[model samples]
Target: MKYFLAFLIFSQTLLASDDWGQNGHRTVGETAENYLKSRVSKKIDRILNGQSIADASTYADEIKSDRAYDEYKPWHYANIPFDQTYAEAEKNPKGDIVFGIEECISKLKSNKLNKEQEQFYLKMLIHLVGDMHQPLHFGLKEDKGANDFKVKWFYNPTNLHSVWDTKMIESYNMSYTELSASLPELSKSEVQSIKSGTLLDWVEESRALTQEVYNSAEADENLSYRYMYDWFNVAQLQMKKAGIRLAVILNDIYS
Candidate 1:
């Protein structure tokens, strides 16, 4: 029974390492929903069949178990090395997060897609925007976005990716709604600044934070209160950025 419990916990951690985990993704989704232009919001509602962005946020991750979605595995992240800009970084043939996002936006903007195709790409756009904001999602290919950078989270063995993806957010024990509500309020100008960057620009921003994350959390280090205390604010800011940027994308595509 004890072993089973341990296995369950380990399994949960592994699941959380994918994408931004449910809470982080949904927090971004919910926050974006609040900022959406009314016409864009209505169009998104029609596409998602009245489903809230928060609820639709995890659809990409949920499809991972099916073999059909194997091609999308790489869509969750872009592995650009620390020294290279995204433009200079070699593109992933299988499609990285950056490619996935651009493709989604391009397809979404085109009038060629049928309603079903439009809905599919729109969902992908929503999820990929959230993924793009996760620092490690723009990390080194060699390390698989720090998945191999094993560390201890309050004494339990885990990897750096999981720490940033879920552990820090989970440690706070808040629902997505609660987390969204607690995000630092930004002025219109501040939000515009965050939303102003291009897709590659945002990728570069996350890559910068990825470097900071790697420097802060060394392999085998035991990270707990201090680590979370220091980085949670950064995570919150990223979430807010993601939300605002998602709204920016949706508004642009629908406008």
Candidate 2:
């Protein structure tokens, strides 16, 4: 069900804060395609019309240009304080990626939405699932999901959030197809391990990684080759795992 976008998630447009970026998100979609069930893949094709998941991957971000979609901005992330569990954390009144993913699953499972909504939420699940795995997307609210935690990427001033979301992936010198192709195939057990978790568990895992990212550098430090060396693999693994986990969910939802 890879590409079928008929009447919805239209021929329109991109990312803001906490976005997982093009290569990262597309890599997740591309990789997930490898694991998708034949039946479910067909359904995805019908729902999305001609749009591949990789293309639908960025629709949530692309729609940011429209004021009508403003409410979805908060759905990109969940930034709780360092010490609090998500349950203990002060919830965003506007909701977060966790809320976004769960709601998408519910609506899709309910099978009550019109054709337009089915396509929209399917696209949403694709994006939010990818975004949720980005450590910065789970970053602290105090730092605007690390947007305020400035760092120089190869002496170019930016922030830690950008570094993980896009910069590091860009430095790897691979297209989404190349990256997805090069990923070592996991054993079924390994895939299951990554998939083995509730949405809340996944969120907590991402939030914990956010801590490591915060600890990676001092604010405004000039990070270059060494930073990429240390963390690029982590980013790759997260994207791969996200793709695998996404396939698992889609199969369950459509099975």
Q: Across residues 1-255, which tens digit of lDDT does each residue of candidate 2 receive? A: 335453233433124323667777888999888889999999999999978888789878878767899998888888888899888988889988888999999999997999899999999999999998898887877789889999999999999988988788778889889988877677888888898988888888888898998999999899999888888888888999899889988999998
Clashes of each: 0, 14
TM-scores for all predictions: 0.93, 0.92
TM-score of candidate 1 relative to the true fold: 0.93
Model 1: per-residue Cα lDDT over 1-255, one tens digit each:
999888766665455459679999999999999989999999899988999999888878766755798898888888877788989988889988888888898898888999888878888888999998889888787888899899999999999988888999999999999999999988988988897867888888888888999999777999999999999989999999999999988998896
lDDT of each: 0.87, 0.85
